[model samples]
Target: MEQLRVTNQDREHVVEHVKAAYAEGRFDELEFEDRLERAMTARTHGDLMPIMSELYGPRGVPMPRPVPPRATPARMHTGPTESPERLAASAAHGLAAIGFPIVGPLIFLLTGGKTSPYIRQHALEALNFHLTVIGASILLPITVVGVVLLPVIWVAAFVLSIAGAVSALTEGSFRYPMTLRLVK
Candidate 1:
């Protein structure tokens, strides 16, 4: 991990704290002068943190931990697409907007998922997208802001479902944006 450099603002903030601590009678004059010097001389977060910790204990200044980047799975098929496969895949996406959000793609997945990788991929995408919609539909209505956006979500889902079907027919694959992809 890279060491985080402390800025002038950080040093000044530490100096202010030292002054406040001294004003509150938390330390003697000599200790105040030592801390003030240390604050002005701090070059990194590590250098300034110890002073704050000494004044207010460990939890007073939290050292930010480095966060790992998240990786989303990519499910794209580049193989040759067949007409029947395209039709099945197209149906998987089209049926979602026709009121079979969960059941339609689920049937396609169970029937053709094992036999055809292309169909499986499309069915899985459709299934996951519909499941996300279902989850949103159930949960979004609980809040005022969510209630207002619920219809918009439904409309987007409808339009995206149509787009997915069209893409499957033409390009043999389509990924829905903002989908959770829980099924995979």
Candidate 2:
């Protein structure tokens, strides 16, 4: 089979994947920088395949292979006070409804996100959702129909923020609907 050429978008996709992998503690800083450089420089599918092979297995594989355990410095708590961490994560979502919007989640992300992946995930979700809401609030006012729906959007954002908080508290997983995910 002939090797397919890779475009800038393809390179960006791979770079993003590499970044996510690094964020998840799949590799160390040096390895991440190396992989990032390789992904950015890739010119063809063949070049990209090997970059992710260790993380996702072969190119045609349907699922990722298991990752062996590694000593990651990011994990801070193991037992006892874990519930407080969950509360903090839940608060990241709840703060959006109370008018903080961007600042609330950004605070949580900067404070605890660097230490705990769970907190980071929840904070980032909340941050992204609020950003999407803010963007909509700014752009939607230009159209008459949007002006009518503006209040509706605000209400939905409020209700959804509460729901997101509840989900983060109970399930540790909550994805806000209609989010832009601009941060990551």
Candidate 3:
């Protein structure tokens, strides 16, 4: 038995063909199982494409055209409404700001669902700033009162930071209240 070398593209195509053929009731159980195994083992475009072409040719199957890759957006723009991810991130930032200060609110204002590299960069910077502030408070302190206070603040910041990061990952907009307004 020859092994099928399949590219990612070819593997995808083969899977589609197998699904369609099985749906049409063209193959008996054994043959379907064999073809499915072959399709799964395919690794490269050269490998899987040929196998699919051969398998589906008898039925006059047409080859699908390759899709062009999408271009990245040049800028980030938000209108009156924002995505849920952004809102969640913003809220997390707001909550964080209560204890951690300016870092959280800044992150919320800067990062939105828009596909701008600059926005992402700023969001990261803001997150980093928040982490640094929290880290510094934990690591450095000359007074006993400051030492005791740091831990309490640290826990609050930690929770808010996690929430903010999750919101950003999910592509939601978040807003925080009572922080320095960096972006409108």
Instruction: Write candidate 3's Cα lDDT for 5-122 as tens digits.
Output: 4466666667788878667666667877877777777655455555566555635575443344464342343322346545544454544556645545454446552454334433
Tens-place lDDT per residue, model 2, 66-173, is 476665544443222478778888899888889999999999999999887778888999999999999999999999999999999999999998998887777447
Tens digits of per-residue lDDT, candidate 1, 28-135, equal: 899999999998988888888889898777986543433534643333456335788888888899899798999989999999787888778888999999999999
Question: lDDT of each prediction vs. the true structure?
Answer: 0.85, 0.84, 0.54
State model 3's lDDT.
0.54
Q: What TM-score does prediction 3 earn?
A: 0.30
List candidate 3 segments past 4 Å from native. 1-76, 79-115, 118-122, 125-128, 131-140, 175-184
Distance from true location, Cα of 139 in model 3, Å: 7.9
Candidate 2, 14: how far from true, in Å?
20
Top candidate on TM-score is 2
Candidate 3, residue 113: CA error in Å?
Answer: 13
lDDT of 1 at 9: 95
TM-score of model number 1: 0.57
Q: Which window of 10 residues has the lowest lDDT sum in candidate 3?
A: 175-184
